[model samples]
Target: MDGGERYQEFDPPKALRPWVRKVWTYACPSPSRTIQRIAPDGCPELILDLGDPYEEADADGVFHLQPPALFAGQMTRPIAIRPVGPVELVALRFHPDGARDWLGRSLRTATDQRLNMTDRLRDLSPPAGDPEAQARQMIDWMAGQRRDDWSIDPLVRTEVEAIHADQPSPPRDASARRALQRRFLDRVGIAPRTLRSVIRFRRVFDHAMAEEAEGWLSAGLDAGYFDQPQLAREFRRFLGCTATEWAREQVELARAIASQSYKPGGPEPG
Candidate 1:
């Protein structure tokens, strides 16, 4: 399966650009479909995961679970098989500057999900006991995510502005960028751009698909592809398929996720 889930877009505060990475929530078919990703460092991740699946792999196969984060030195290009069951996950991709010390361990690795300063994620969660409540709770949770606290005070807010626009993928302020980036790399511990690129790239398709276009060429170009071949190259690079094959799956997955039973406010009816 490829591109089967309903992925939501999110932007991080610009001021936190050096420290904060990308953040988002995704809903997909359960028992997630497999995705083969080609990372920047020549590392190929054959990922088959559920919500917030983290890194672990071998020849026998792969295993995924939430927390117990890992160190991803740089951002990687992603390609995924379609998901098979319903899934909801909140994700934060680390920027190079946002690098943290304990990213290589599980959520319980350093101090547990709470004090894990590797990514130094903050949570101002309100109480929620059930599914529906959780959804509503996350809506608000995401709201606070907008405030990137410069310091990790638990309920802290950073002064960074969110940069969700596709244009500045390459930053203009090299010096200042490097300074804030130093804060992430030297202190916190992992790559925030790694988090930004993957999450941003994923959302690119999520938004592209909603337009109900005919092919991947058009979609990629709209996102500023140099040419159809360029788009195809990236498609194959990330997804292990040509543009046509990937487009075919995108269409199928969209339909699968949008069957008549799909409802936004209610449970994904089976």
Candidate 2:
């Protein structure tokens, strides 16, 4: 067996770049039960479990063993993952609008939910082999379905970019905004306002983490929040904890786990 942990990211083939982010893999040997907390990010994910199935704890503390292959929608709250044994995961992260285009289905069906993709994966000819092989097969499947002029709606794409790049302002006109919200829901799975909230919360969290000395107010302002109180409210709403509490816990387990995989000849995680 390979010693220590292994985690790496690979760029998708040029043809798949528009809809897909990078392909990444992470694996670590069996260890005491460990939980990794992932905060909401705007991106959705398609994941294949290459090892033992991991248990997922939702916001309400209910746990379920994840399916072998599943698609995760845009996360709105923190989700905790507890690995049963060894951990091995190969993931294909899609751009906010990318999965909608490739799936050719309303992303709304899977928003904020995890759906089993085992049957969909099994339908492909030449069964998936390993992590890398499965990713390639998935890419090929998407490639086969691509059309000559495949593209996300220009308006949706623009809005998605705007949400991520700067403070997402509500449309000036309420009626027109409602219409766009409906369209965004159809094309993007989640409501545009909700997506904006998730992105804004992520920005604040990341800023606070990166600049601990700047104080939460500064971090909040930098991330477009109105003030420190607003930032704290968002922290509790999305993360189920206050900024100070979460930072004190330093449950940045995902990054720490990934770092373990990067260590050369380092001991396997436990």
On TM-score, the candidate that comes out on top is 2
Model 1 Cα lDDT, one tens digit per residue, 90-125: 444433223232243221122101222224333433
- Give candidate 2's TM-score: 0.79
List the candidates' TM-scores in order.
0.41, 0.79
For model 2, which pairs clash? none
CA-lDDT, candidates in order: 0.36, 0.67
Per-residue CA lDDT of model 2 for 151-219, tens digit only, reads 767677777777776646545598877777777876678888888777767655654444363676675
Q: How high is the lDDT of residue 264 in model 2?
A: 14
Residue-level lDDT for 14 in candidate 1: 54
In candidate 1, how many Å is residue 70 off?
A: 9.9
